[model samples]
Target: EKVAVVKEEVRSAAYKANVVKAERDALRLSLSVQETTQKKQVEQLQTLIEVAKAGNQDYSISNEESIKQTLNVSEQLNEQAHAEMQEMRAKIARLEANASSEIQNLEQKVKVVEAVLVGEVPAKRMRRRVKTKMKAAGV
Candidate 1:
């Protein structure tokens, strides 16, 4: 009778341990699935960022006024897209201004380089020509 009781006690303990282990395994699997889902969401957000950057390309703008209007619509939508649109507009505006400034600087540098190549024309003469062109263009 003592031996039988001991065996039954051992079996009961083993069964309880197995049940507890199974629950732990299930919890681990649930946690893993949740992690995977969260990772996918993060990747999707990254893709949206890339798409927003693409929209900032200057060549893509057919008409600035029309685009500005559409931007106004997007701003009204309060969609996730609105944030991206606003960000792209601000970045593109800054980039365009910088690019225009750089282009002007490069043009001036090129004229200086040309003067250097063609032998000495006084700096004053080149400056006069550039100034005249700018005045003519109202810039």
Candidate 2:
């Protein structure tokens, strides 16, 4: 009977470990997906800028200022995207580190299996962070 109990405990620990690993994997996967999407968007912005530059050359001088402003806006967008991507990468690194340490701490706890048995999976990963844009002073 003792042998059976020990075996069950071992299995529970293994299951918890697997779940923790899966959670970490899911987190990392999400960051990679976001990075890929952001990279593609940056590429698109570059193409748009190039197209705008070529278009500006063909426009009359009277429209030159407008095209130049458009080009400037496109450049600003590219810079902003790159900055956001870098910030996101930093966030992923921090989150990954925290998750690894959390998993280690959780491994030392004995009741993880009960949580598992009752289907109490952690839902923190599903939360989305929202950033509201602030309006400029003039528009």
lDDT of 1 at 111: 51
Let me know the TM-score candidate 1 reaches against the reference structure.
Answer: 0.39
TM-score of each: 0.39, 0.42
- What are the lDDT scores of the predictions, listed in order? 0.53, 0.53
User: How far in Å is the alpha carbon of 57 misplaced in model 2?
Assistant: 3.6
Alpha carbon lDDT at 83, candidate 1: 57
Candidate 2 residue-wise lDDT, 3-102, digit = tens: 3443465566566556666765776677667657766765665676567668766746545566567656766766776677667667666655665655
Per-residue lDDT tens digits for candidate 1, residues 1-139, read 4334434544555565556556556655665565566556555655555565577675344454455565555444444444554565565556556555544544544454444446555688876775575455333
